[model samples]
Target: MRGSFLYIFGGIMDYRKTVIDKLKEVDSIKDIDIESILEIPKDSSMGDFSFPCFRLASVFRKSPDAIANEIAAVIKTDLNIKKIEVVKGYLNFFINKSKMMEETFEKIFSLKERYGFSYIGEKKNVIVEFSSPNIAKPFHIGHLCSTVIGNSLANIYEALGYHVIKVNHLGDWGTQFGKLMVAYENWGDDEKLKEEPIKELLRIYVKFHDEAEENPSLEEQARYRFKLLEDGCEKETQLWEYFRTMSLKEFEKIYRRLNISFDSYAGEQFYSDKMPEVISLLEEKGLLVDSQNAKVVNLDDYDMPPCLIVKSDGASIYATRDIAAAIYRVRNYHFDKNLYIVGTPQALHFKQFFKVLELMGYPWSSDCRHIGFGLVKFKDKKLATRKGDVINLEEVLDESVARTLDIMKQSASEVDDYTKTSEIVGIGAIIFTFLKKTRERDLIFSWEDTLNFEGETGPYVQYSYSRAKSILRKANFNENTPYDCDYLKEEVEIDLLSKLSKFGEMILEAAKRDEPSVIARYAVNISQTFNSFYNANRVIVEDKNVMNARLNLVYAFSIVIKNALALLGIEVVEIM
Candidate 1:
């Protein structure tokens, strides 16, 4: 390929692209997409990159082995490939280790913190709507998935040069507020409500539901109060405003501890005024129909139930507000993509919502995506807010910090600030656990898995980074001096360099799949790889050339690992 593209970083070539470009010289396979069939060999003994010739057997009208032999003999070899081996039907290409090491190390040192960033998402705008916790309720563990996942996705997009808009999309409107109003009026204590707003509000919220079983008229009264709120009754509006303000003040404490922020706190209430405009647009397009005296969009043709926009009693539902909010975002931000990081239970709701937008002749509706994740379970039991069975997020954060501190004390590890460092590692542990797996799978929260420093957890990666820092400090490494790649000819060094070389490619792949776990898992693999290299050879050897090369390798690894964890919304501590 001649290394034609000088991507964001300097002199770092894509080896896979090099192999594919070389293969394109063959006339028979020139028309084929060689990139799709290229694979990284499982065993390093085979080769660095492999190209199977089985798919070309039909065109050549010969056996797979014969095709492989013919292609290997005639393929171009002017690139950084040391040798090519034809094993059975596979064409394995061994990379030139010295060139690979030099290129990777040079790129890392040149770019530093900007390593692995690209311009793939240049000039695009993305809106990430997540952590839409209900006001007047506890911020429990159930909200963790959307909050962290959405935040990490934002970070990933920004690394690729995308303009990201983070929206909290607070759940601040509905009949639930009516129930809260009734409960507060009858049983609320003003002093307690002021002391712990979320707790007192949650208590009253649960009581309203419990009392409605014996007295059914309470349900009717709740609905009437909601209608009054919708009608802008002076008393109800004042109460709603007071509760919303208190809830935001309480939610800020948890967000600050987690180091998460939002560009917009515009909740469902923000769209209340925009809903009528959406309804009018639907009517103009002949997409809204009357069903059971309620406004709905018929979707039987799409094999889904009708999407209800308004209740029979003339009240707007969630779908109404969501459609309005989406339209508002497109007009204001002109977003290229809008993503919803809600739970899997709301899958059907989004499907119906998107279909309605499509029917209304909006081409941008296709860019609106729903990123749903599985529920959070404790002891295999799902949490419910109305039942008062939930784990507060603040409690989890505080307890994790305390547990981390206890472990540090038992191990006799000394740090300047025990509490502050422990809090960083502790919260990082929880966030990493939530992101280390695919979002579709349910996550079970446990003390052992979260706090395990020896496992494939966040603390392990953080510890590895700390160890690298310690080594560099002991040796007093000088980055200004040039290092020789010739001395780094060990097998372990090659493997670590190969892994480090793929960071930029791995980042783009993660963005393509819309999965943050890709980066999380990469952090674990790279940490383990660096540890293996350290255990096999010493960085502080007698020879100046060998010591300098290994030190540079260690420095490159530290930089890459820190960048990977940052993409997952994780922070690394210098001491552990």
Candidate 2:
């Protein structure tokens, strides 16, 4: 079911491939990887694709235009290449749009849900660790980036035939847990904790810090509690386990709302028992050093602060646990790539630990990646959990759904299931807003931009998809019936078909870049192009062949849009 698209779209995968094959014939550039240099023109008027002649000028000893013309002279028009134009020393090829439409529509109609699936990652393994919120803390807006980005990457990898293990490495072990325990014992309301675990826990946790500011000895008390936890004291361990259990329950509710699931819930505490083995290995490797009554791996030669393995209190630090976890994952999963979708602020920590792994003679340390993202801020204010200045993700999602429902009511749209549709749109709106921009860019949440039905937002994408579905319904599109692509001759129709065909290509690119924004931006582009096609031509035309072609195109668009959104971990509504 999954591999059928390859056989169907085989040679006619895309115009880019055709251009690469055609450009391979030019002797002067035969040594170069033509695919790397081939580029899509920013403006459609420039041509469908362009290759700069600037690089070839040095070899040919000619001006870029002269080289472009020389290359154009030999590469005659083929079945895939309709025409080649030289503009400002660039070789721009206009694709055979009719052939593209025929091949694209056939694959889209035949493969259905499996249209974008590829076999590039066959037999490969990858571990995507994300959405790892601290235990007993609110899952705030700041954590959203890692959650969606990691989930989307896992989805993208699976689409490309990689066995992905999604991990939520919960921050279940830390001094914070000790502080939370102290706060719970001192000021926690058991009734409130049962009613709202995260909220009540966060309240007392914040209060502990506030009081600790006045009572300096509270810090020592928190450390003592943490030492008890480390020493495996029965009471401390039980309380820790209780906190962890409650946190996981709360987290599961949020995960269900987002439609996300994880293969592993292993947190820092999972490595507590495993750390001794790692420290032993480090000691054997002669990597561990003494630094200010702590175990350290000096990285001064690499221009980094020494990675502290064990603190002065003999407690293992995050670096030590991370090293243990990486070793465990490699031995267990044998992952080709182990990606950590964390914040950019922790760049040094990852680099230091990964370097320590390398120094310890682990070659796979190079395969470990730190997929860092920028901060998430509400307007100008940054979200800080410690400061109690954070918005719960559930609150944002609820408001989004409410606003979407209000919008639907105001617009008086046909909503068969108002609750379901509103949730999809509202939740999807927040997810899309995070994904629409580059992950490295700090996100500033905006209500106006997020739920705008007409803007390039989640609702806009969902509505576009629903609109396409509506068109297919009106035209009575049938999957079993044959359709002709010959009648899809209008520019907008061809453009829409062109975008539809790139779905697989887009997925492959997203996988390669480790960026879900590629898929997000592509979805918006497809929606915008689809809208243009719908406005220009009516699908249910008087001409039978034309209507069939247009309807088939609409069906194809709907599938591609839905698949694109799915890759971003956003749900689509058939009617919005």
Candidate 3:
């Protein structure tokens, strides 16, 4: 039954190809590959869809214009395709406006929120690891990209019908914990911690680092403390548990505000007991070797650096824990794909880690993927928490909400729900800002640029939706009212309808590329196109037929905007 449903739903798989399939039935060409035939013309006036025949000219041994004319001739005979023209090696297609609008709008309204979602991934499970912040450290803006981007990718995958497991991968077991423990024992005040948790912890951490520079012995002490912690010292274990529990409470608040929840909160500590088994398997597979008082996996055969799984003191490193984590996930969930939403600096580390896994003869290692993104810097300066130069993520969220509230108060009149609208706009702005560019490119943080309401910003798109909502409210559409698609023959209306048809395609592309920015950009494009239509076409005009059709178009626009925003982890409000 599931297979039959998949086959039926798969007919609408590639929308771009659907347009080609329609063009192929023209009976002029014996064969047609839409991708090779069609080209989106630079100018809007060319047509909604265009096919350039320049490439075909070489095969046919004829002038480009002549081949274009041949295709256009066949297109002209089809009633569904209203107009076809050939100009400079290009065949332009214009659909019958009324039919196109009616059919497209009906399909969109019928699907509703599920319009763009598909079973492309089927039942495949994807494991995503992200937001692996160290315990006892403040969650700063530097960590925002990984958290939001990872969560958004997970959301995108799930929407596309993949079983997504979000793993926090917290930095729970590390030398930093040892240093914190030492600081706590020497000068830490219990009353101060009860009063101010993160602040007091941060002060002690900073003090440890500052003092360590002058006292080299402090470094050895820190390492020995970590060794003791790893050796299962009762006191160290209790302290580590206390720190993790306290820190998670603070982290949960931020995660709730952002609407991000993980299926698994397992961090480095989760794989502690599993590391020995991993080492035993590695040694059995003849992958592990002794290297300078450590258990290392040599990767020179694959032209990669060796990976250290255990230090001289028999403490497991990140590579060891990661290998255990990977093996555990594969066995536990049987995931088809595993995604690590880590930063670019650790790109080499993951490369080495995966290479070692492959050498260990884990065939499923090929299915593992590391989705590395560039750093999020402040004014081109790296945000170093040790140097106390980091911005808090909570502060960024608070400021964005405050700014959005101020804008709503000044511009909007009688906001139906101020709190809801503020949350929507504020969260939407942050998500859009983070996803505005490709993940591979480094972005400099700037509030002025991110919060811009006038241009290609989140608020701009949200405002477009709000504007459509306002029009719908004023139009008071009724179920019995019949819409006249003929009223939507205007240029802006045609353009918007064409843009709306590509929503499903856009979502698929974003999912395939693992980039949410594709959807973000499409939202801006749709909103911009709709705004142009709204400015030129009057919805509540004197003509009842025209008003009803225009209202239907706006209603459809609202649905698309809301759906797109949801995919980006943004909230949509009816009024702001």
Candidate 4:
């Protein structure tokens, strides 16, 4: 709405609508809106915004390059447009430099720390189910992906004005608890159990599997004990609750270290009693079929396996519980979207459940999504929980923090609080390393690659934030003051401002796709860009106006980078 400039991303119905309206002069491009075809030029040389004319080419009966050139000629030079060009069938438009700096810096300086905030999802409620570690199990590196990714998504959705229900869907149900009880009864020690519950519990659970291999009858005993627990046998129920309590206490330590908070601790058990309602609904919808003495929803017509709802003995399985949970969540939270942060192995399972929901006549079933991430392998080998081959999450965190401390001691970056910054940097390094890749892509765990601070890692971004703060602190000017935007017209300065300008749009895109990697990549890029700008131009110059503008850029970079890092669940320290 500023009279002097056309704000690109932040402005509503401005330059984009203008371009779309002008492109309507070509009758072939009528149906396309700016959202559908607008893309940032992959190379900056291609210009600020690009519109590919390939789709319109077939209708226009001309080559895309020719159409692009015609469209470029059609768009007149306005106050907002510096020029338009045709680059290989893409209509790329460049904005006036002075206007870009003024709009970007002014918006960033005005928004300050709230640079990435948006109200796009104001009325929507999103339920994010993640970090569902099984009760009485040691927190392992296997659980890291879900915890960090899910928490980041929750933060991202909240940042975009969605009321996020951060649900820690603890895996506290199933026959596993029965097996844990059997192991605890046979090999458990009281004092050791109280001192190191999950470890001790895990030790005995592994022993049960080891012994069960020899004495196969122990497996039957485990199943029978599980049955009793399900039947609400008093002692079994009490033991299960005790294990859950002790395990939660241990898990809380890790959650606190990561600063993750959950709005709901409801696990599978919360929906245990509610499954019959789902089963009854399936029957009402004529979806329940008797297959091999089990209640199932026949999905063979859809080229999927039959979704078993109930066993021959009338016991429900995972799909049944999930069905009940979905119904419960919809009726309870009335969520616009339900996200399941799980491993890729369960893709079929989620698809099966979601299909069943559709068959049961839930119109909002399409809103459910499984944010499946690839498994984390140790030395390229899969880890087993029952076999005790997993790496304890606590151990990983402690070791990473210790390594961070050692690195800090060797470096000359004057960190004020070594202990606090080490924890932040170490945890951030691990999180950044995990998030740097696409969520759906499998990441190989390597200590050297993950902990490297020099590369595009969390520590690198954190260091950028710290460096920005340090630069601003040297001026003793934490307060924002209006400056002549014309002073920041250098190439690197404009590049930094352009990156800062796209921060909000990136957050919105990430939230829409449920991919935090977009913001993660953006954080690394902005950090690199700011570093380049710092190397090219000195911020502490003698010219007061130029110096203030540079300092504002530094402060803006620090705040935007910090905000992006926070969305990814990474914290920035004053120094590193």
Candidate 5:
């Protein structure tokens, strides 16, 4: 395994390879001397490694089939390649199966939970801003997309060995807060506030909206209150602080259940003091221009709409605070990348924001990314908390749990402790349902689909695992018994093993794409394959050798299921 052969094999074996090695392999071709040609086949039956020989036909003065056969012959003689075949002018190489299986399993079992993780992002810092709910507003189904998407992105990056800083970016410094303060002052009730903080706050907010529709002065009053808050009015600041703190206490309960934590709660208010510096930097860069009595950044050159840095009333805008936040994150954390997990509606906002930073002559601004996702729409209508057309996230979680409990009661008659099982099934269902689809797609929230415990659903996967556990328990599998991989030669067994080999690649791909749905999809696939294998072939047979081998496979499946579930922020119980 020296020279071009070794380099090609090395590049194929490990995804992280230098370009020089790949080039060397390409240059070493005897007759053709091609630059590069490689592709992962569309299906497993097409072979693991494929290279198109059509390009080489011109150089070699022969037909593509001739070139493909020549390449196939060379690959067949190579010791690293177990087999080589030519199909439709393409050369396919299948590495030795046993060697690949052993090496993959060794890496997986040795690394355990950290098997798929890598240090490609070592020495890199990434700031992920997400879950930024407005203070005193109800945390509704709409907010769930951002919170989970952002949190999962942070987890994915951290797992890839990046220094991740999670920020809430709370909407604590907006005109809405002013309206809330004024409404509270006008129609404030102490006992009602204590009894139902969010409901009462929302009531006052709705009242302000309704009143502002009739009494135009109330709109101006709200703006004046916001200006005072911006000017560091003592009372306004006090009220903002109280509202933020109280709101966070409620938000924390949901965050705790979701297993999401932030490194900092640096919202708009936190970046207010840095706005002047941002404005000065913009002026120095000659990017700031006065437009309609407001400080604006003209981004026409970048084909983006103008960004308002300051309103006509001399109050800072969200874009200004975001710019300051970006600068502060780079200077303080020395982040290699800053990821903003906002909604797609704010796509233009980020475009202008990043464009402004680029105009300011920051090189790292080019690396800052905005991971935008589609909205979570319900069947009735799109979520609108302002109009009270919203479903509370807390209620969703509660309902998920209750539904799981109902299912558990219908099944599992021998269960003595149903409460614990219900909790696991319920929470698992919610998390899995959320992650089962592509992040870019808008999920139509359906109770029926979420509770459907069949066909690629979360409950189905959990039940498969439970079934495996039940079989293993009944067989009384002895850990001390010796197991051999040779018994794993059946088509079903090989299918499961092949999937197990792909776990590391799956995680790496998921992290790269910033989508946990990849892992969810893989988990479902593995569970289905394993269940099929278990059904077609007896895992706990009377024969000791077969039983031991099957038990080993089952144990391996359990490890993978648990690891994949953990990455998605789900817990897998031993029994369930």
Candidate 6:
């Protein structure tokens, strides 16, 4: 049974190809789209794989049940299958389990860290634009969803062999900077700025709003300053440049804690010069319409807000800059797909902008997508920066780390590098909390929910990985340890294998849908499955062969879980 596993495994590895090949043998229905008809049965007892015959009923001029019966009878002789059965209108296949275990485990151990990844996506490029925080502003809690989701999507794409360009489209330009500059001039203090850059900036921003309520003319002055900066005035440009630099330095600390990196920091400011070419293109294409002396793209037909190109005072808005940025990215990166990871509130904004691109007759406008995520609220109240009801991301991370340290001390835990481990678990908790939900749903971050150790939080998954690592260390598990795939017939072992087998499929789905929750939830499943397997089976058993096989299974699970966590932008600590 063990020796015959490989021959059977090789045949079933490409189940669709094998099934299609077998269907081709029946001369009466040779042109079947068998791939579309295949399905994974909800009940494992039904079969390993199944194909529905509803569509083929019309082609074969027979009932679905009859077509399934005929196809099942012809496919049974294939070496990969143990048996084929027609139940109702579906053809079900039962792949040999021993063979599956051997091929999967052996390949898993051989490939080790690179198990689920493949080169099927070679030569494709993806540009993931995410976590784009506004310059001179605090990295607030609201920015959490986009930051981690975008990073994880980039990782998922890369894992599937796409050359992913992680672009941080920083919010570094616009009329707002003029207000910031005016605020700094009125209340600028070098010592305060050096001590707390983003906080001081936010302080002045709030101050600007407060004062501007009484001093209505202040808005005009701010816009005038912005025009000066846009005109490349030495003093204004230098001030704006200083703000951008200082804000980035502060953001770097948070990015370091989250372990996220970006390939490009080309923000709205980077496209300042490029906007002219876009404006020229829009004008040349006769898409730019003047409404109330402001340049706009009339898109009432798309049921979206008009894409504002230029203000009445001749200043460019977000839509105008984005148009320039999108065209520049297509010309520069030649991306297979360009994603904008923004909030759901901006759905209309992106639609308007993308519609303008479509109106310009750019064929690749279809390749650009807006991956909109919902907002994060606190205490069931809406969070708005203008209201000053915001929690800084850096401060939240610091508090999480401190909380993690307290938990460790309270539990009297024994883990290496308390400082490093605390940061890992704390940041992991934050990242996991954000990624664990569907991007389109609103999340309220509760202290109890984020730090829960026994639940589906990041700590739970990290703890599982840590548990697997500890077991492997205790068993002195070796890569070359000889083991038999036959010894792993336990229900727990098969359950664990079932979870590990879906790693590749999970990644592909996550990338395709631009959703990180798929991988986040799947990681939790693998972790829970490993814990169940650990309790039911003993790895340091008396039987050396069974022990080796179980240990290898443990090692394989650890790799898959670690890979999953990494994709979610969560770090895995050896012990929690």
Q: What tens digits encode model 1's per-residue C-alpha lDDT throughout 191-210? A: 98899999899888888888
Write down the RMSD of candidate 1 (Cα, Å). Answer: 2.3
lDDT tens digits by residue: candidate 3, 327-410? 999999999999998888888898999888888888999888888788776662332334467567776787789888998889
Candidate 6: where is the Cα deviation over 4 Å? 1-13, 23-32, 53-71, 86-90, 379-387
| lDDT ranking from best candidate downward | 1, 2, 4, 6, 3, 5
The estimated TM-scores of all candidates read 0.96, 0.94, 0.92, 0.92, 0.91, 0.92
- All candidates in order of TM-score, best leading: 1, 2, 4, 6, 3, 5
- What TM-score does prediction 4 earn? 0.92
Query: Which residue pairs collide, candidate 6?
Result: none
What is candidate 6's CA lDDT for residue 363? 87
Clashing pairs in 2: none
Could you give candidate 5's per-residue lDDT for residues 1-576 as a string of tens digits? 224322322223442122223323543364343324667678767776677778877777888888777655443233445666789998766655555555555655567677666666778888888889888988865577788777777777777788899989988888898898889899877677767677778889999989889998987888899889989999999888877887888889899888788999988899989999999988988888999999898878777789999899888889998899999888899988788877788888888899888889999998888888787766534223344565777777877888888887788445556778777777778778778888878887676777786777778888877777777778786455566767777877766866786776676688768788998899999999998999899887777777887787786777777778777777776564
C-alpha-based local distance difference test score of model 4: 0.84
TM-score of 6: 0.92
**Over 4 Å off in model 4, which ranges?**
1-13, 25-38, 51-74, 86-90, 378-387
Model 6 — which ten-residue stretch has the worst lDDT?
2-11
Alpha-carbon shift of residue 391 in model 3 (angstroms)? 0.9
lDDT of 6 by residue, 1-576 (tens): 322322332323455456556766776667766556677889877887888888878877999999888766665554566778888998888766666677678667767777677665579889999999999887876567888999999988998888999999999998889999999999878798988998899889889988999998889999999999999999999999899999999999888878889999999999998888888999999988999999998888877777789999998888888888888889888999999999999888888888888899988899999998888866523223344576667667888899898887777557878899989998889888898989999987776778876788988899889889998888888788887878998977977886687677787778778999999999988888888888887889999889988988898898889889888888788876
* lDDT score for candidate 2 against the true structure: 0.87
lDDT of 3: 0.81
Question: Which should have the higher TM-score, number 1 or number 6?
Answer: 1
